[model samples]
Target: MSLSKANKSAYFAWLKHPGHYLFFKIFIWFWLTIIGTVAALVFLSNITAINAVSNEPLYGPMKKNLIYTAKSIERSAVKHKRTLSEVLVHPRLSKRKLLYLSAAQSDDSLSNKEVPESIDLSLLNFTQNMSPQIIFTEKYQAFGPVNIKVPEGSFYLYEIDINHQPPLIMRFKLMPNWMKIVIAIVASLILSFVFSRNLIAPINSLKKAAIKLSAGNLSARADISVNRKDELGILGRDFNSMANQLELLISSQKRLLADISHELRSPLTRLKMATGLAQMQANDASQSYLLRIEKEANQLDKMIADVLQVSRLEAKSQALSLQKQSLQIIVDHVINDAQFEAKQNNKQLNIVGAVDVNINCDESLIASALENLLRNAIKYANNTISITLKHADAIYIEICDDGSGVPNEQLGKLCEPFFRQSDARDRVSGGTGLGLAIAKNAITAHGGSLVLSNKEQGGLCANITLPLIKE
Candidate 1:
């Protein structure tokens, strides 16, 4: 996918993810708060104070002790007046394991001793002004004291060298404490995940319930009676209460409308009969007036029937009698009726598809919806009206007309009962303005949608989308 498309997909996927919101909140809360607090304390206690003196040399005390031992060894040698070979077999040499001090020259028999080989022969060339140096190697370390030359007087007396194992502190090496860090991070992640999940679960349930309620499932409720001592528990309770009240209110309204419409039918029937009897006795001039009254009565009856149908569709107790029917046949019938009406207004009606598709729906309700759309389009169409059908993941039927479309601001209100555009269309066409509203309710009852928009080419387009039946 392209970068923009991939980013959009990832964003929508994250929105759908259950823990997405909680992840960031918990991560920030844990790391910035809990981890930061612990890290600060550890740094102050372990790192900051130690760092002040850490750079100082660790071998200073050992060097001083070695110098003291060297002085004592010199005193012992002077008192004994022993040869360099005798010094190698000295009791002090055998007793000390850490410090091995010895004296020797290349020509002397002591030079062949194992202890003297630990010292370098070039140390005998050291001048009085030069300080002794400590040299470290892989095997052993050697320290040669100042003013100590390899040869002195008749023999090499000041060829003093100290060779022993390296100190423990000096052998220190730096290494990362990765195991502790890994354990800390893993523990943080697990704790944060648990915290976020607990925090977000109720909110997610409430969101899903709200979405379902908005989509016409009034029975949808958060139903989260979790034993949480937080704001979310209270909110969930409030949401359930609100849903129940709304369902009750809407149910009452639907019942009232249905009852009123049913009661109005009796009076309307008697009026139609009275108008028919009066028309039989009326004069030619009064006959036109009687016909106008009859037309208005018929319009009112039609409007009442539409209102009743809308109420029935909205009532959750009413179930649809769905059956498999040819969608093409329905479309063709609507087109044939619309064409006759369109001819009266000097408009051409055309169909742009022949694909026969079957759908599971209430056939009469679906037919009524299409007919209402076609009739509305025929009334407003200036010259040409087109009906187009296509199928993809769902079935799409678009009815368009070449006429000045409704104002952009009023398009959304068109589906509302008794809502008409600020124009002469309704007045001239004698529309009760409930046709589109009833059709919308009928389409919604079938789990379909009816959308109205102005085409880019200067006309109004009504698009209906319905879910396809799986065969």
Candidate 2:
């Protein structure tokens, strides 16, 4: 069946307001969380790197130790009258600390034996000045290139410690900043998409179940698995429970209505038989009263039958016997009967549009519903009534009359069981008030709708729309 106007409008409204969707909100939140965490880590790393470069704990101690090693080498070379190479090989000076010295100009250095092969020596560019520089690598920290003068030529001294590894801040510094951000964004997008899908999947199932339940599918239930233990899982379980309770309650009510109507029908039948017997035995004066009693009993019987039909429709107790039939044949039968009634009542009923379409429906139910609507129009119409049929997305059967329109406030209640307007359209009009209600229920059972409205010029228009069966 096609979606109703209200369902279509709600879908469009959701499309129009994208920000109202839970998926959008959840995706954005997850994305922001991932980006924020990456940014925080980057910020902390930068701060730590800066602190290591300027703080006294790392930079100060490394500088002092480099200067002291340089001085010790120079003093040993001058006092022992030995070359700087011999002083560097001395076990007493070389084994004093886990430090290595590399010459700035010469390739000869202790780095090859003491440091990892990944350390790049070109990073340390020494000048003629006595000040030392610090260099960080993944595996080692080097404070280096101190100018050591020993009466011979000047020597460039580099102090390297193999045991001192770079911190977390320096390790990430190897990658470019833009690359880091790009990686973070890509990772966040993937993670956020997965997270939002996992979160919204169950919710979408719940929403579908709710729509089905609201659309008169009492057996509709959320397709949530028992393995889900989250809050959304709990909500789905609760929704299914509510739907079950609602279906049970409505089923019980429908059954109760049908049972009550059946019970009343027995008494009404006996009352009608008694009234007939009385009419047979009564005198002329009592004849009219007995006739009125028979008329009221007939009306009561009709009302009870209507009540039974409505309950059956509500409970879906009787399956529709559907067949592909010509719409024109059905309309012609109802119109012929209605037109004869209209002529008897001094009213004109005319068919204004073609009814050549074929539809899948229960013939008896559709014909009965149309008959009820036409009779209602005949009863209320002053001079003329019109039946107009049109086929578009669905088949539309509009029955309009030239009677005084109902009050605007009471229009919505016209199809309700036993609902009567307060003015000229009361019980005195020989109506049980269940005709429109039965018609509505019958049309609804066929996956169609009966809408009642007041014509602007003056009249009541009952429009019946039914879904066209696909070939």
Candidate 3:
């Protein structure tokens, strides 16, 4: 599609809206968020290790103590010749280290009341009967400090003489491997932000072009200056080519319609003039021949006019000489004019409820549409016809007739140029089958609608709607 600069910029603005761009930003932000989160964990681990072992690596001693406690219990068990549980009564790795073991019907119950150096006594449970083989466990308060790991169901409790002996405290911390990974992840995400921005730039341009195309500015073309000479640039080039072809095709079609309409005008005018002269010179028998000629010429004149109108509509050059007018007045007037023809066809004309309505529309154009619709209804009407006007958001003009209405299968095709419900009837009726088609075109030109449907009262109802002046 090809579009003007103003439309292009407007569409670009829509794409660049906060909500749209926010999504792209969020995609990059969240991906980076994950990376940053991982990297943060990694950095924290390194910091923790540097803080703990940079000088003396104190955790090594704490770890050694837990192992020592386990082995000590083992030796004591052998020396005392009781199972490890009975010999040591669960040695304390710290003042609060766990010192309990769940063995197979444990050789002896040896639970010390000292909490494990790394565990909270109230937060853990030990069951000797279930999975007794799981001899050890690590404990740490998530989102808190005092981190530690130790043998499961193990604690040492002894009523100590505090004044005589100094209380011992075991402090152990883990190697911060998780923190190191987090730091690496954070760094990667930061880089990803830059990458995502570069990736989406071309997409943003295409988005703008699409919006411009939708807004009736079909000339929009994308500019891809991305450093990566990949698919994005190719897409931009493709879009430009498509826009060029579309513009050319539309321009050509408009010119073709205009030229054809101009060419048809001369022949149609000549036929009308000849028919009029023939009618003026006609005698008794010649009257029927002259009448046929006049009818055919008038039909041709009407078709030529419709062709010109359609051409103007296509070129977007339809200028409306709009005036504030009463829809009811126009309806009544057209009905009066069409009534003579309805009477000549041995049909009855009936006017329904009157509606007081006003709208701004092209007077002659709207009148012509209504005139055509009423004449069509009269032609097929089986002796009875009704015209109605109603006030709503728009003024409605409805003309209905009691005749064998259009077949169910032919409704949609009725609006096509030269389409008629019954070809033989239309030929006998002396119409060129352009009445309804012309009415449709005229209504559309007035920014309104004309709809035809079978009326329940045994005929066709041509419904017209035109926007009323809001003020």
Question: Which candidate has the highest lDDT of all?
Answer: 2
Off by over 4 Å in 2: 1-15, 19-30, 46-120, 124-173, 190-217, 220-239, 343-350, 378-386, 400-416, 419-424, 451-461
lDDT of 2 at 425: 55
Query: Residue-wise lDDT of candidate 2 within 1-471, one digit each (tens)?
Result: 999999788645645776989887898999999999998887765663442231112358767877887888888879989876677668776565445555545665542134556755544543225356666655566666677777666666666666775665566764466777998899999999899889988998999999999766799999998989999999999999999999999889778878989999888888999999998899999999999999888877887888888777766787899999998899898888887899999999878777688888899999999999999999889999988888888899899999998899888788877787754556557787778988998899889999899998999999999998877
Model 3's TM-score against the true structure: 0.54
lDDT of 1 by residue, 1-471 (tens): 456987687445645763656646665686556556645544443452221111222257656665665555555557666544465467766455533333333343233235544445443333223344454332345444422222232332223334444444323211123533554567666777677667767887898899999766899999576676689999999999999999999889878878999999999999999999999999999999999999999988988988888777776455788998898888888778887888888899878876388888888888899999988888888889898889888899999998899889888788877788854768888887788987888888888899999988888999999988887
| Candidate number of the best TM-score | 2
lDDT of each: 0.69, 0.79, 0.62
lDDT at position 141, candidate 2: 69
Task: Give, for candidate 2, the lowest lDDT window spanning 10 residues.
Answer: 49-58
Error at 8, model 2, angstroms: 12
Give the alpha carbon lDDT tens digit for every residue of 340-420 in model 3: 888788888888777677778787878888888888888888888888867767777788888889886787677766677
- TM-score per prediction, in order, is 0.65, 0.70, 0.54
Off by over 4 Å in 1: 1-12, 15-27, 41-176, 316-319, 406-412
